[model samples]
Target: MHWESRHERAPAVTVLAVGAYTVDFYIFGDRLPSVGETVAATGTASAHGGKAANVAVAAARLGGRARFIGAVGGDQEGAEALATLTRDGVDVSACPRTDPPTARSFICLDSRGQQYIMTWAGAADGLTADVAAAGAALLRPGAVLVLQGEIPVAVSAAAAAAAVPGVTVVLNPSPVEPFTQPRSDPDAARLLARADLVVLNAAECRRLIGERAGSTPSGLSAEAAQLRRQIRTATVVVTVGAQGALVIREGSEMHVPAPEVKVVDTTGAGDGFVGALAAGIAAGMPLAEAVLLACRAAAVSVTRQFCIPSYPRASELSHAPLSPRQC
Candidate 1:
């Protein structure tokens, strides 16, 4: 089904995104240069991008009320980041600029549409529990708190905890790493328990499972099941690029297929998926239906270039040529 953004002037739900903010430099070249090799970039562009920023912009473009709670550097990039969010109709009052330079990502894309990104956390690493708590206050019963792994784990945990009982907490653990928090840390426990849904890609799922297992395991299906069991309180959705995603919830599991699309630059596809998914769920769409809409949005994202620019507006999705893939 082709779902369009039907949000009214007064949106029924709000999306509060807590994570990183960065200025992205996209360098397109014929190929990746080897050590000591100099290959001139064929093209280049700069944009405001970071997982949280991208998600916020995407949510807003899809007609959701998006509020961002993150940190930016005290430099020009920070100013630009805030301006971009404002232009996208996202609320940025909760985001603060810090002493350090704003985060930056140098994305290298080749002719084949593959991307390699090097990101500097910079001010994004400065997110603290106090800052997160202030943002959490905005959460209401039906609000959505979207968290990503780009910021300090403690901050993500705090934001999750701030969600009231009826609020839906969605955690996207991209750039996932081993749990450094001691097993006894109650904050970590709360982080896992509070998430109503956890969205992650296949590699993140494997790495998280590996961290818990003390070693890397084999088989995607088995590992996915293990991840679901480990994060027992939340429904797990593992995305496999092109093939789509695996959704595990309430003692059942199934696959959702994504429409095939030619890739250009995959900078913000996952963020687009997560953001649209949050918007759909906040609009009261069922989990499975939301995933389908998210997958469609993501497929549209990879066919374009850059980050926020690649995200499809609600009207664009309505007119997209690709038919919905069978769920």
Candidate 2:
């Protein structure tokens, strides 16, 4: 399956990211500070780091017509985040300004590229409305609706409901709250059921399925298939850092290998993967091929520091031959 041929044959599908927005402050140090102990940082940087915003920026940079539907604070930080998205070619016309200040995150990265993050939801939680409204206004047939767990469950649920018939929904259940929380998330469960595809990591897969995942090839495939049924989605993708990403469609499973690269920072790598995956789907690449592109994009992102700043544009990604391992 040639990428150019597939992309050329199908019409371009729009990508809409509807979720959270935050300004992240990163502190780089030789090592992460232990709990109750303060450690000095070697360097600090601030950037846009919300999952939804990252996805929008990533999709746009990868050549997708991407739009963002979320709220930002009426502050300089919020202003910068919106500007960053704009410069990255993400449509922010539907993003509204809210009060109580923008969201913020503090990330501490070690020399080995390991990181620990703490976030404050801030104004991201105060929005009176707009997520569903903007999503409804922009989403239509042939469009891709992207959602994440950073936003309120109600917000995600509303946006999912607003999606026009024929629109494809992609959910990335990051943070794994829906599966980790003691209380059941009906909204999240329903959203998962409605999604055409769901992307998560290995740990998230375990949490969702309420057990340990299979480590062996056959074990992974079996667990992934079980996870798909549990989530009630037609397709599910579980990303395994370094090893690659797994794609499970209905009952079949395939593994797409990650490109070898130096790791400067792991921040936003998953977002890059999700964004690139969504963009590839919008461009008409087959699921397995799209996962391949996504893995390549993620590999490129980890080679640099920061979140959105480290993302690679479509031209920056070297095309790798698609060779997905089957389960």
* TM-score on alpha carbons, each prediction: 0.87, 0.89
Q: What's the CA error at residue 120 for candidate 2, in Å?
A: 0.9
lDDT of each: 0.78, 0.78
lDDT of 2: 0.78
What is the number of backbone collisions in each predicted candidate, taken in the order shown?
A: 1, 0
- Model 1 TM-score, 2 decimals: 0.87
Task: Encode model 1's per-residue lDDT on 124-205: one tens digit a residue.
Answer: 9887888887787657655678988788778889878766766678888767652424266666566766778889887777
Best by TM-score: 2
lDDT (10s digit) by residue, model 2, range 181-220: 4237777777887788889888787777777544554476
